[model samples]
Target: MLALLLAALQAAAPSPGPAPSPQSPSQIAAEAPAAEWVDITPNDLLVMELAPAATGRPRRIVIQLVPPPFSAPWVANIRTLARARWWDGTSVNRVQDNYVAQWGDATEAKPLPDGLLTGTEAGYTTQLDQQDSVVAGHVEHTLTPPITALRRADGGLEVDPYARGGVGFVGGFPVGNEGYGSPDTWPLHCYGAVGVGRNLSPDTGYGAELYAVIGHAPRHLDRNIAVVGRVIEGIEHLSSLPRGTGALGFYERPEERVAIRSIRLGSDLPAADRPRLQYLAEGGATMTRFIAARQNREPPFFIRPAGGADICNVPVPVRAAP
Candidate 1:
């Protein structure tokens, strides 16, 4: 009887499978080596404070500016605006459902600070320094030096629905280009991307009016708008806002606007107040694993790994500095 009881207990116990792997993307990122992390300087951070929520919770959004070699003029203008306190007392006037949340001087009467750069429509894309040469029976190309590492598979190329050539991470941002060796590269409109609002085609925005993508990845807007930065923290403050009723999601009533308390560069804040953040280095082993994990979800939850992923789906991992 004791042996029978022991056998029943053993039968009821679940069998262990291969030690469960890092089943999620977050787990992969958590296991990344410390050396594979990259720090975000305070100067590159744009800190925007919104009026507290109904619950009285302070809402602060931290935006990390796109580094050099892309959107230079707009980024510079944003820095200047932050330093000049240009966005103080502004308001988010638009909250398009599955689109964007825009903020600026709603009155449209506030004067922009001096030294704002007038970026051209051409500034929408950065032309990489491309030099093609054949090396060892392979078409080798030397492109611009990358600021943010990129994941290059099969000679730096990946399938993309928007970009005929391909899509990949460049300078830590998702960029679509003609091909692996294409000279023209433009930032993508992924969720949380911060972009300059402009008039018609002729007027590239000078960084005064800004919007954050709060919905799906609007790939169609790529190369048509200037993506200067991405919201690294507190995106929920913008994404969870009430949608606008007016045309194009602009708030019809003035009372509908969400007020902006202040916008400042992180560098201007006191050391303790400054946000210290970091991103997992792209092209690093850990990032590769993270992307793979995202593409192919493992056991416990997902039944079948998709075996593929959208470029936007594999966003780089950012975290508060340890």
Candidate 2:
């Protein structure tokens, strides 16, 4: 009877399958089906034209505005400013090393167009769709299970130093929440992120003055400032500019500032001039593969996989629309 039982147990054991092949993040993204890519609406695109580089190459930066339900008032003001051509003739006034590249009226005297609304400090964070319950004065987020691609293989949320709820892509932008199940979610300050320049509290920026993070990801600035958009293309134009000599990276001399030719919404541009772009959808199968590959480095250049990746390190893949 013992011999029979042993034979049965051995038969019941499952056969082993082949080990999965390793793939790099870019490889996974390239292999993704076209259907996994989502088109960016022209109306939501902000195109800024800077003066040509010394090499005479045209310099154009494409910015994708955060979708509605986040920074609504500031977004509205940005649209208004663009329609009125308010940023024309303005200059990039600051280029702080390992920080940001700022622009607007360096004179700080540009008259904002009419109908531009002032954003309040409260607008900095958007309430989460998921509700929170208070337990002993501590808020507990009741997160729904595994909604994003940025989850561990066993369905655990990725860890983030800046967000207790952890970080994930929201509308193709990296965002953090209070907890995995927390009630508040806000956009992040990853490199190439664009935000409004404000003086101090109670004075949220009106979107007239803007800055693009050209250095390290300033996670500390996450919920403190209004992150209006991000540089989807031509970021090198801003990142490679000379560092500012004045305080806070502001140019000390007027001649040092880089001039802005124009800033316009893609919808306002002619069909021939408008740019069409797309990003991998956050919950798509391709995005899941991409995230996994990013967390685990493969064997071409690396001998050992890192096992984990920073939220900012896993940038969503954005490319020209096919």
Clashing pairs in 1: 148-171, 165-178
How high a TM-score does candidate 2 get? 0.87
What is candidate 1's lDDT per residue for 257-300, written digit by digit as tens?
99999999989999999998887766668888887777778777
TM-score of every prediction relative to native: 0.87, 0.87
lDDT of each: 0.82, 0.83
Measured by TM-score, how close is model 1 to the native structure?
0.87
Give candidate 1 regions above 4 Å deviation.
Answer: 1-18, 130-156
- Collision pairs in model 2: 141-181, 165-179, 165-180
Candidate 1 lDDT trough over 10 residues, lowest sum: 132-141
